[model samples]
Target: MTTICVDVMGADKEPAVLLEGVAQALAADTDLEVLVAGAAEFVEPFAASHDRARALVTTEVITMSEHPAQAVRAKKDASIVRAAAAVRAGEADGLFSAGSTGAVLTAATFGVGRLKGIKRPALSLPFPGISGRPTVFLDMGANADVRPDVIVQFAQMGRAYARAVLGVAEPRVGLLCNGSEETKGSEMALAYHEALAAADCGFAGNAEGTDILAGTFDVIVADGFTGNVALKSIEGTGKFVLKRLKAAMGASLKNKIGMALLAGSLKSLAGELSGDEYGGAVLLGLRAPVLKGHGATSARAVCQGTLAAVRVVRAGLTEKIADACELSA
Candidate 1:
């Protein structure tokens, strides 16, 4: 069974919203277990009712206003902190949260700790591609600036992830750049281009932003700044298009019937652009798996995120990454 620690206080909808997702996950998978961290009053009752769920009994929670590192250090009893501690202590297999991104990163880095030789933690998000397989992108927002070694590490870690979780053998890796040419992109992108070329991991040439969802590559390596910007841009455009599409579909009864007839197609298309279908973002280079659902994530997304963590753990992602990457530890 895959036991995961869940931070239930800081989500957009808080304890109630989180419980529903936990319940959904419990109902869906008999092999999955969740230990919810929150006030005793909230978590205890919920855990009592569910067969696979347990209560961590935390009293404090880190909010968005508090600084990430400071709050983690001071709020020892915070939900996120306690959850991470649980994973580190071997009480849980991994960590999952919809709290502040900064808090999640800080907790994972300090509480669960990093793998050997890894100075930074990275956020790797799955981007749905045309091939029905997702292309993973790294350093979504962990570090705005990273060295060449970090970028190289991202590719190595990503390869392990694709193999373990995505079931891809010899995943194709790419460096995100303005152009497909080797001459384009910043010095860092160019540096990794040369580094990956010599590495054993399958390195595809530089890929443009348009190639991200085109199924051009299985892994895209980038600095946090560029990767975050590209991610938000893609999400924003997807939302805009969906909003307009909905408006057009609801314009008239005729369109409604037409859409109803094509509901399956539309739903499939929407799934491709949805955050829920993607199962949130995974924090890489840590001792254990850590997944962060979006702040405004729905109950389904929350459930999917929990399931994603379980999948990663069962796949032995952490072990695979440590073994594949040459670490000092």
Candidate 2:
């Protein structure tokens, strides 16, 4: 059984909704075990109602709205800290927290430590691809300001993630930039591109923003600033398109019929694009598994995030990341 620790107080929704998600995950995977850190009174009842209150999961209950560092420090019994401690102690294979990205990162940093030669850790997000392949985007916000060398490390990290999550043997990697031209984007990007090209790790040259949704490569690397902008742009475009579709469908009966015919397919497609459906972002190049859930995550997202963490541990991503980082270094 893979033990996964989750910060139950992390999401915008409180223990109620998040705990409900824990229930959902438990229902989906009977072999899995979850250790929730949050209010025990809130979580215990939910566990008891399902009769899983006992052996399937244990509760640690940390409060919401606590300062990231202070909460982790002062709340010796805080859920998030306990979860991190669990990972450090080898009691859990991975940790998931939707509460605060900074807190989660800080806790994981202190709890798990960094991989050899990796100066900064990255957040890796998998985007749905064309032809059903998954594309990975790295440094999504783990480090806002990064050096050229760090971007190269991000590429290697992205490559390892694609291999582990997408099962691509030798994933093609591309640098995210304004244009495909060698001179486009930042000076740092140009230098990093040249570095990756020289290193020989399946680098696929540069990729423009337009190429991301088209899924041209298995991995796309960028500094946190560029990557976060690209991620938000894609997410915003998706939401905007859906809004327009809804408006169009409501305007007339013909459009309504059209939407009715396409609703199921559209839902499946949207699900594929949703961050929630992907579970959460993985903090790469760390000694232990650290999954960061979206702040707006619901119970389903928490449950799925825990599952994703399990897959990360099972993939032996920590070892893969260390190997990749050593090569990149």
Candidate 3:
């Protein structure tokens, strides 16, 4: 059975949302189980109600503003720390949290420990793609400053993710750049291309930002700064388009009738673009699977994120990444 430890506190929504997520997860997968870390009184009742969920009972909660490293060490019983510890101690197969991203990253790296040959672990997000699967985009907001070697690492991990989650046997890896030309990006891009081309994975050469959602490649690699900006832009644009569509559909009775005629298709398209459907990003290259849920996590989003983590754990991503990292190194 695959067990995932989830931090049930410090999300944009209440801890109760995580419980809703747990109930959804139990209903979705028959072979999955969850361990929740948070205040016992508040969380235990929910755990008792669910056959697959168990509460760890933690008192300390780490807020976004707290120092990640210090809070981790000082508050041994903090939800995030204890969640990571569960993975480290073999009590769970993975960890999930919608808490402070920095603290979660710190806990996964320091508490659970980095996999062998991993210099820096990356936050890999699945961006909506035209081909009905999300393109694995790495360094979503982890490590603003990166090296060529780091890009190489991202490429390997991203390919593994696409293969595992998306059922792509051999994913095409692209280095995100300003233009499609090999010489278009900065020195880092040039260096990355050179290194990635020789690596074991399928290197698709330079890809422009436009190619991200166009299904040009299954895996897209970028520096954290660039990747984060692109991710936010994609998210904002998706929201903007959805809002405009809603307004246009409700503009008049005639338009509303037309929308009603195409409502099924529109709903499908909306689901394709919804971030909640995709759940959240995975922090790659760690010793165990770690999923970072959206801060404004809904019940559906939590369910999606937990399921994604289960996919990663069943994929044996941690062991596969360790083997691939050594080869790339």
**What would the TM-score be for candidate 3 when compared with the true structure?**
0.91
The lDDT values for all models are 0.86, 0.77, 0.84
Best by TM-score: 1
RMSD in angstroms between candidate 2 and the native structure over all alpha carbons? 3.1
What's each prediction's TM-score?
0.93, 0.88, 0.91
- Write the residue-wise lDDT of candidate 1 on 1-329 in tens digits: 88988888887776888888888988999999889999998899999999989999988988877799999989899999999999999999998899988999999899999987776879998888877668998878899998777788888898899899998988999998999998987777888788878876678889889977887799998889998898888888887876776787889998778777877877766655655676789999999999998877667778888888899999999989887687644
RMSD, every candidate, angstroms? 2.0, 3.1, 2.4
For residues 127-214, write the lDDT of model 2, one tens digit per residue.
8877677788887877778887787788888888888776899999999987988778688888888888877567888998877767
Count clashing residue pairs in model 3: 0
**Of 1 and 2, the candidate ranking higher by lDDT:** 1
For model 3 the local lDDT of residue 125 reads 78
Rank list by lDDT: 1, 3, 2
lDDT of 3 by residue, 149-217 (tens): 888889988888888777888899999998988878788778888989888867998888887788878
Q: After superposition, how far is residue 243 of candidate 1 from its true place, in Å?
A: 1.7
* Residue runs of model 1 more than 4 Å from their true location after superposition: 249-253, 256-271
